[model samples]
Target chain A: MKISNKKQTLAFLKKHFIMQLATSYKDKPAVAVMLYAVDNNFNIYFATHKDSQKSQNLLKNPNASLSIWEHHSALIQASGVVSVVKDAKEQSKIMDRLADAATEDESFWPPVFRIKGDEYIIFKISLSWARILDLEQDTIRQKDTPFTELNFK
Target chain B: MSETKKALIILNDSDPVLGRVCKNKFKKQAGWDTILSSTYDEAIKIIVQKKPGFLITDIILKNSVKDGLDLLKFIRESDDKDIAKMPVIVFTDLGQEPDKKRAFDLGANEYLVKTELRIADVIKRIEKFIS
Candidate 1:
């Protein structure tokens, strides 16, 4: 569904945790399931291994999109410019937020997967536009509602 | 290092724009992960699970199932001190004397009229309670 009101949009964004972040570099495109923390401007922050393919892709081409949903429905799809968060203080803040959100058990599995040290790259997606799609709703409503644009600078 | 905290915002309207603005204000100004819950059930669920650092809510929610007052009652009457004492700031257009009195009676830490304050001012008030 096309949602223009800020209240509903923010509600949808805050309710979810994971976002399918898609990035493209040259002819290759990649998508990764990431735990993200979004700021007021709809800028998304997530951590990944520095050597990860997504990181390499973003380096070459910053254009990206994110597909976020709840219970397999109410999808909020967004397109944005992506870049690594290089500021030390901002990096620490995002890393700490990620660490707080991560499960303790996740730490035991892969150290590289966790948001720790300089080994991980923190990527920030500055949203250009976004839209909502609710497949669970009726076809008429889905068809009538246009994609709501999220034009945040 | 200080632990990152979350805040819960309860509203009756399901407007996406306001939701984003509220979340952005709380997240950017106060550095709190703002969770927006449109329904009473959703609000209660997040309150219990997240134990948000604080709460900002509108009094008159369209959802008749349970309004913001019911949520306040739940928080105040809960046996959990953390939940019961969690700072609550009422942010709504309902600004009658009785409404304010009732909210205070229900243990609202602060009350703000939607018209009297700008969004920035609302966030400023929230910062006081959370920070």
Candidate 2:
């Protein structure tokens, strides 16, 4: 599965966590953080509180985006729309699978696990499109050959 | 980062265009070596075989019954303690607030947005972390 320029892309994916889930209400911005899981099909999955702000925002407007990035390892980032699942049966199936993959913390249940006896949320983010950026591997200018390429420093 | 570290990328989807972009950023801007991959099954194999200081992976991988996020969970929960604690970076297209929260809740060290993040910026940020 190695691709041509695999170095930077892999670096970007390596040591990062904490995705930014974005939702809006009447054009107002809302953001939240949650645990996420990725499937082999290239789908991003995550869970959250049914009564959370993001849930309310999604209820009003499901249109949203999620950002997963690294502070280090070059400039690798991904953003795209999220498809929210509200069906209890379907959500349960997805969450059950995710729970199996999750750690003890990831698999934990909150007191409000279900609201009105309905709990658990699952979201999938599809790539409207994707981009990869890594500015840390610049080597062309450092060929060690002396050609008067101007250096700012 | 003193421009002294190497970068390894492991992903499930075979996207050369995006891979090139990420390689250029770290190699040219931050001064590091970079490696990329297109699948989680293979990527995890690499991790198990070798110990890399850092990792960049796609949450949504290709050719797997599971995606990159699931890979992260496996690594964290696996019996191999060494890899379970390694720094993990997630490359995904999900930028929503809830999505971000869930990724972290699962155990990803950081998340990157594909579109908004640029090469130079990524390099700078990575440099800051490793440096």
Reference-based lDDT, each prediction: 0.73, 0.58
In order, what is each prediction's RMSD in angstroms? Answer: 18.9, 19.4
Measured against the true two-chain complex, the DockQ scores of the candidates, in the order shown, are: 0.02, 0.02
Query: Which ten-residue region of model 1 chain B has the weakest summed lDDT?
Result: B12-21
lDDT of 2 by residue, B1-131 (tens): 46466567864343332454455545544667766666777777777877566777777765677887887888889787878887777766678888788878989888887655654555555554474
Whole-model alpha-carbon lDDT for candidate 2: 0.58
True contacts kept of each: 0.00, 0.00
Q: Where in model 2 is the C-alpha error above 4 Å?
A: A1-153, B1-3, B12-14
Q: Residue by residue across A2-88, what tens digits does model 1's lDDT show?
A: 346556777677666578888878888898887777776677888777668888898888888999886535778888998889998
Best by lDDT: 1
Query: What DockQ does model 2 achieve?
Result: 0.02
Q: Give one digit per residue, the lDDT tens place, for model 2 in A1-153.
A: 111243433333332334567788886888876555555444566666556777777777766666555432233334546678778676655654444333223223322222232233567765443444333344665444321111111
CAPRI-style docking class of model 1 based on DockQ: incorrect
Which 10-residue window in model 2 chain A sums to the lowest lDDT? A144-153
